[model samples]
Target chain A: MKNATGIWALLLGLTLAEVALAYPSLAPAVFLLVLLALSVGKSALIIAFFMHLRFASRALTLALFPILIALILLLLGFLPDAQRVMHAA
Target chain B: MTRNETTWEGGGSPFAIGAKPLGMWLFVVSDALTFSTMLMVYTYSRLANPHWPAPFAFSPSIVQATVMTFVLLSSSLTMVWAVDAMKRDDRRKTVQYLSATMFLGIVFIVIHMREWVHLINDEHITLTANPWNQPLFGATFFGLTGLHMAHVTIGVVYLGIVALGTRMGKFKTDHVETSGLYWHFVDLVWMFIFPMVYLMSVKR
Candidate 1:
């Protein structure tokens, strides 16, 4: 991330957006969705640019891929709970 | 198999991804898993109990946390600048950037400690109980957030060592980049923690 300062500026904007949208006035579902989305985007930016993953070799990328997948899949696993499943009688 | 024919005998990069950085990457992934599992547990418990209270407020805690987040994010930027300086082999500039990063890191820890005091003393929250009468909430809150705070505290000290080593002409580009990787990983963890711990906990 040669443009280190610029990346910081973008991160600050996203963070402020998260704070702004997290207010009680906003609907809970929308607030959670937007904030989580923004956080994921911020993580991507940091990993690719600041962490130099973009310049990393294919082998390194492959090495890191499964860890990232596990995190995402953990969240996806919660989808059924968020869906409010019916209990078996 | 003689020493003369051994290409590895000479000083060369050990791994395809560069040995030091590859090791750092492994550490980052393992650390990520640690925090991720803690956070996922928090989420699961929070979801399991619909009545989980939103104890974090905007008055003192949230605002302070927001500032702390900014501090950490800014520190990451400074760390990157330090790496850039190292790339140019400018020891002076590298030291300056590293010092700035360390300063911001200390500032973050101070602000976080203050907030923790507020939460514990003023809010009467602890690992066991709080004003919310939801002890489980406090447990998860302190457990996860406390773990993250420990990381920031350790990072400050870690960067301090790197800064001193760099000033003494001990560290080079690879070492600086390795430290940068660690710092950025801590920031990345907070990027997720901030929203989950503070933003998501706010009442709506």
Candidate 2:
């Protein structure tokens, strides 16, 4: 809980790595995947450390993450259909 | 079990946190879904359009956004410090850290507005139309960033109120911690936004 500055530094470093990764001429899918993984890593650090969720009850974390992840997955499920409709048009 | 142990039937908080912070967590979940949907829509648009515009250049746009990210991350650190100070019952340092957080949030807003102006005026990228002729670019870019900026603006005001209340001996540790939760949520949203919207669209 006390390592706020350390967490902040890690977030900054990840951000810089994100930008550097963008500079490379990687494949689009690869670039997007890396960007997303790094972004998710940054978010996890912030949520766990900065928000003190790591110190919170396991019940709270359990109740929150599952629903959030499920909702995100539900939203993602529509992407293929969206593309299908666009292709038909 | 012992007297220290409580159960759901005993009318105790199963989450072991105050209602205020729990409420903030709920709000964070809802707000996160909103941003996630928007980002998904942006991704769909980007994938659908063959000529999606990558309008951000390295010199100004990316650099400005990186600085903004730094500012926001620094503000989150300040917010954490503020909450820590409040937990220790050092009201003076709590208010000081809160003030520092608010100042950094304002700095973030200023930088963001400047970037928006640069895009609108110099780059001719509006909410609906852009020189790229790929209108979804303008729409999604502005929509996501605009929503995030609005949150930052509101967070600054929210922190200001908390700081003033804490200074006047009105609010307590829970209040400061609750506000910090909101501020940290805002920072995390920007964590996703900076990469998806800005880094992905960086002009190569």
Best by DockQ: 2
RMSD, every candidate, angstroms: 3.3, 2.6
What is the C-alpha lDDT profile of model 1 across B1-204, one tens digit per residue?
A: 443443266444433556789889988888888887788767655555556677678878778888998999999998989999999999999999999988998898889889888888987888898776778888887888888888888888888888899899998789899999999999999998888778878744
Off by over 4 Å in 2: A79-89, B1-6
Question: DockQ for each candidate?
Answer: 0.48, 0.63
Docking class of 2: medium
TM-score of each: 0.89, 0.94
As a whole number from 0 to 100, the lDDT of residue A4 in candidate 1 is 73
Residues A43-84, candidate 1, lDDT per residue (tens digit)?
999999899898887767887777677776776587447436
- The regions of model 1 sitting more than 4 angstroms off are A24-30, A82-89, B1-15
Model 1 interface RMSD over true interface Cα atoms: 2.8
How many residue pairs clash in each candidate at the backbone level? 0, 0
Residues B1-204, candidate 2: write the lDDT tens digits: 456655666567889998999999999999999999999888777656656788889979999999999999999998988998998999999999999999999999999999999999999998889987988888888899999999999999999999999999999999999999999999999998998888878897
Candidate 2 chain B — worst ten consecutive residues by lDDT sum? B1-10
Predicted structure with the largest TM-score when compared to the true one: 2
